[model samples]
Target: MTNSNHQWKKTALSVVLTASLLGTASMPSAMAASAAPEAAVTTDALKAASVGQASGTIAGTPLLQSYALTDKLQVEIKSLLNETTSEGTRIAAVVRVRSSDANVAKIPDLELRVKTADGYEYPMQASVFNAHAIRPGTTEELNFLVKVDRRSPSELTELVWYAVDWYSYPKKETVQLAVPVKGQEWTGPLSSFANSASSVLPWERSFTLSPALESPLVYTPVSVNRDNTPQGPVTTVKMRVENPSATKEAVPDFTIDGRSNGNGSTDKTVFPGKRVEASPLVLEPKEQRYIHFAIPTDKDTVLTNFNVLTPETFRQLDPKGQPSQVSYNVGRYQVALPVTSRTAEFNAAKPYEPGQPFVFDSLSDTIDPHLSVSMVEFHRHENEGEGYQTVIAKLLLTNNSDLPVPVPTFQTKLITAQGMTYSGNRQTGAIAEIMPQTSYAVSYAFNMPTENEDEQYVLKFTDAKTAAPASTTIGAYRVAMQETKLDVANMSFYPFKVKLNDWTLNARYNVPSALSPNTPISYTYRMKLDMDIARNEHVVVDPNSSKMQLELVDKTGRILSTKSLPFSGVNRLISGPQFIQFDTLRTEEHEYPLDINIYEVITTPTGEAKRLVGVLKQ
Candidate 1:
């Protein structure tokens, strides 16, 4: 990498030396070639996409420059453009600046100010990088990321300028720029402008909402003024209302908000799967109506870029703010989230039986963050002893932010026991950061002992984002050994006496336990081998390991391993509409009560661990 940097330096130097190689006029072309196609413009206003701005303070130089074109515009259009935005349009065009008198020793204090055709200019994010040059061609890619809220272009009216302080470059030195541009627009329709290529639309603009509202509700099944109540998980939007009109007595004042992004600009921001409300809009004589209503968003949606055609329908609107505030009595208006009217469900397993399913959202679907959750696979093992059940899940993390957003792999409580919880392996906690809309996947594993015991699990994503009323969801699996063969169970010993009842066993060519039924026997107590078959067809009689074991000896204590046969019903796996089998396992040997030691192990992503399954012997 170091060597590559050296090569790049050499190339840059050679280009500088070539002087005429890359012409000054080619800069714009180069930038265009690197970026995607520019957004379509309908207004004479500048494109409002999140683009980086040039940084640093322009000292003494006027930020706005004007020139009287010898060629007058057939129809002049003045727009007061602002780079502010609504939610979801967070991609910023960062702009940085350094003075021409950059001294390696001193760092300058840089401040940025944006000018509007309204003669208003505001400061942006801090442009802090410092260099020696005070007037060096200051450059920055401004990340003034914001979605457009309104459409009426803030066209470059008369002059555009900014004031900057050359902090360290020269203590109190400052600069500005004032460029002149003859923006033209058509007085009539595009057809008229089409005939006159010299004329453009009086306005061309777009906007989005902040923090982006997802799956917003516009109204109930039936309601007026989009009086939809907010339900389920959602973000909040604060709108500022202003009635910039003279006569507050605008009889029957009406205004509405619209989502300029979807449905070709006619759709309201309030749609299914979202919530909406009407602001108290009234024009008393000359009073302005700045009604604040919160509208939920579906994904990152474009906001109110619609114009207030008339006070009967609209007096003002701003769709780029949170909730993408809109002002219009515009009939058939849309200002709620335009999400899928139908709900989406993710059932972990199917047949859609009685069991639970991991719910993303209710009637209204939940907007999911970029999370890559892999399917959870389950397994059951048995042979030597009662088996173990295991469940595994994983996800990867991606940086999905214009800026770094801290992401933590949190532990959602999974039902461990009746009331026990594994909190998680705190020491080995997972952690990472997701940058501007990135994606990531991480894995967590869990396991437990299962001898037909029903178990449940859970996983929750409680980070800065991905919050909900439940604040969690079901990430569970019931422990059961499927496709099981033999399941033996033992009945209690004869409780009436120390030893009684008819208990017997036949040996092929050896001794047995208790010769009580034998005239002359080699051993006393007999060992009976009883097996409970689960899958009737899966149970087979052969020398295969599928059989049970038994042993017996005389008082001298001679260890003996004996063969045993199946005894009992062919316990079928009992296939049902949904597999729900509950059975037990046990050995059928009474040969002096041999000590049986069983060790159960379950698997998890981290690894396997010993699971205490309780002792069965004295």
Candidate 2:
């Protein structure tokens, strides 16, 4: 095998560790060596210190500017310095890295120290490196701070920058570079959260918690009244539990018990003001959930630390040979977070507002920092038939976290001015994957009351993942009309055409008598489509782009209701012959005149959008 290939294999351990640590690897020996220096030396005296340089490229990567560590890794010293302080002399170094291969790289652990001729080593006090994953062929920087005795510089014979590569191969630990004093702060995006709780599980299970364990119960200050009742002051702690165990073991719950002191007192207090989480509390094997609790306290009284509990139930054979139920706690777990502070902040936000986009203003997943939702482009549309209308909305979902989670769907409702409510239809998009840092547009269609035009309505979005209650309001909007009389029902609309042969008038079978203001309510519509548009080409419809509008009226042409339906439910890919169903409307009078307008969108060869307007009168 080639030497390069061998080196790559040898370095695999370091590489995996770097990735796991998110580029913030640490070295115990290096950290322990950073202690008080024994001697001191002036700046001029350190100027004569010995400087070492790499003889040649080490690991395929060239020693372009400074130290060479391995075949694929090299460090370029940016600056170094030594300054005298009241307690001792401080040494600092600024360095960056260069890698030869295309693999992602990170400098999780880098340490620097000065070794005097007298066998004393002054280790770096703090080292901050850009721990972010670096694309191969790119460089990452790190800053180091060290303190030593002023006299140590005079006897300093070597300054070393320690490094280990991705493969866990210990590279050259000592290399010489010019030292100049400078300070740097580590400023990089925080690493994504990863829970390793499964490793410490008492029994085999699929999930873990972000904070593997809780802190030992601690004391916090609280207030008490003259009657000894706990008053103001409260402490809170947050925790996340993740399920990554086998599928069968995925159902789990987290709980904290509030047992009373049983002191035979009239006040049967069970950790007064202790709040418990509500749950069936089962999670998918790979799901992570969060919870928090607050305890009221007073400086004069100490609240008891509640016992954390997680129960699992099973159906099994009993000693009597009959199937029986059994429940048990996972372990004697304690709360991991502390309520050391006297009080916690609780910020309350409004839940609903009209005339604005509907936003569920809470994180969907307790453990994930990404995946949120917003609803926009809310409007009203009138159907072509009498007494029917629908509200159309666009859902703009976004993901800013590194985890590529499935997009979530929200339950929605439309509240009319008369206090009546209606439900929306499910118009799913063709989205399969929600990549990080990307957004998807989802469409929603809500059936509305016919008398709601020119009157305000409330649109609300509810996320099943969150308990926060919030809603968005949409104001009264004017329903506009666009019409064009077609010469024939068989006319073509760029990508599609309407078929006049399938036209028919049918009774509104689903309308209840109470909802029908007149007798013989009926619906008029046609099977609208032309199959010859694309025999081989595929029709791709974006959920956010296409729409269907409808308006219903009485015999005298009095407008009843208006509604709109976005083409969000259209098949993502269409080929061969496809049929289109026009809006279905319900009216009390069967002989009312109908005005139908079909708006179809087609993309031209150059990507220009063309709208096909077809109007039908019966």
Candidate 3:
């Protein structure tokens, strides 16, 4: 796998390099961070990066800093699923610690935790690390290391985890490993919700192979919707037979039911293994055809999740129609696609380079499943170095339109340090057919004069994928400027009423990259806190770049987080960490309501001011 390391996944948003792994199998293998040493801190204040630089943890979360995985100490954590029916924590993790830190001559006590998606914390214990003394800066290699977590068959998102800091020094930097966990979903008791249930066609003998026609089956209704409608759904399911021309085959029956909580419906069928007998449909000679059924979608989002149902007699249980006491205790389920919201975090989207493909996770969007970008171009990169003149251009052309929406196109006009707009297609441009919601980008390289630190350009586009096209200007920068100091006092996330505890976060405005001016730029960051825990009970700040602050306001006029700025704006191009951080602090025992204003000396003519939160320990 190209970028399969656990560290890469956790730190991608902050790290300068983009993850190159395009395929799934070639991704991170980190289960979670290793356990903390007997006396390490497990709070959310560790260093963000260690070796080449990495992300510490998500903002607002309990995790603090980097894990100092020294040369000799070996520690690894893995979330495992419990393998049996016995009631115990089925999903767990294992830890192996050994002496690599020369400071510890013997194995030290270890503390471990398996943090779940909902932010639940579970701690575990395991072996210790055993090693000897080490020379200064010596890399003592430890031997064996592994985590033994039981595997379960039910899990949605992977088990996301990070461990507290380990006090062990000399051996720094903890390793992370992510193990692929797959399991069945949690289906609760159905006795209360199930309206009616039954299993159809449990067994049949197959007689033919290729000619598939119709097979008799049955479906039992399970629950009722809020309107008291039959919750169980009816749908046709196509199947692929392994042995189409078999002399004899066992075909099982299936059923459709609702989810345990009666939210959505589910389908499950009993399987009698290879013992059931069934006959394949025999079609007219040389006449193979497909059949369709009217599966209603009134209460079901997916029409293909029906499961096979079986009777107790198939298991040699009492032939009586009475349900078996223990054999059929579990709820039945089938494969169905559930409806979910379409989302892509705007904070992660706004600042983008034209040439680089947009990172929209469209899996949930109802985009035309077949629409695709034919050409995405950026005529020239907005910012070029000091000496020569450069250009950035692009062309977006596609033929699919199941999903339609107006697309934004950029036009460039070059301006000099003296603030002069010369003749050029620099400001804004337009195109047709690039229908609504069907947006993409393109880019081109440009060379600029050697003395110029940056070039400026404005972009025009319809703000939302709305029908009416609106004109708006977006800035692009070719930053290679002289030293500048940046300061701000108040910061806030409005409309949503940012709690003092949640608004102190900072964002890296520009991450230094090879694509930027090949020169080191000096920058200073400062801030003032309007934090008055004893007095100011409400945390609020100005959201717009007006007489008091900077940046655009949300629809509700509240300012979005600093992380939402367009760090990649061509006219306002920054080459730092892509995102910029003012000062952000976290005091463990403070309930300071967030309310502060932040200002930036971004440029002489143009700049920004914001409101955010800050908390420093006394």
Pick the lDDT winner.
Answer: 2
TM-scores of all models?
A: 0.23, 0.27, 0.17
Count: clashes, candidate 3: 142
In model 3, where is the ten-residue run with the lowest total lDDT?
Answer: 57-66
The number of the candidate with the highest TM-score is 2
- Candidate 1 lDDT at 455 equals 34
Candidate 1 steric clashes: 145
lDDT of 2 by residue, 1-618 (tens): 475455433334333333233222222232213311211222233333212111221111111133344556665544344444456655554556668767886544546676655676777644322344567887666555555656433334455655535465554353323221111111111101122221222211122221212211111211111111134444343344455454523323445433333443345333423223565455565555544445444433443334344333334445887756433332222222223332111111133342233333332333234655555345554443545665565556666677676756555555553445555554555665577776665556666556666444455443323322221221122222223355444543322343443333333443538766665535544333322222112223354355433344455666544445443355432333434443444444454466554444322222212233455566
Expressed as tens digits, the lDDT of each residue in 102-139 for candidate 3 is 35444333333444444443443321222334443333
lDDT scores of the candidates, listed in order:
0.28, 0.41, 0.28
Deviation (Å) of 241 in candidate 1:
35
True-structure lDDT of candidate 1: 0.28
On a 0 to 1 TM-score scale, where does candidate 3 land against the true structure?
0.17
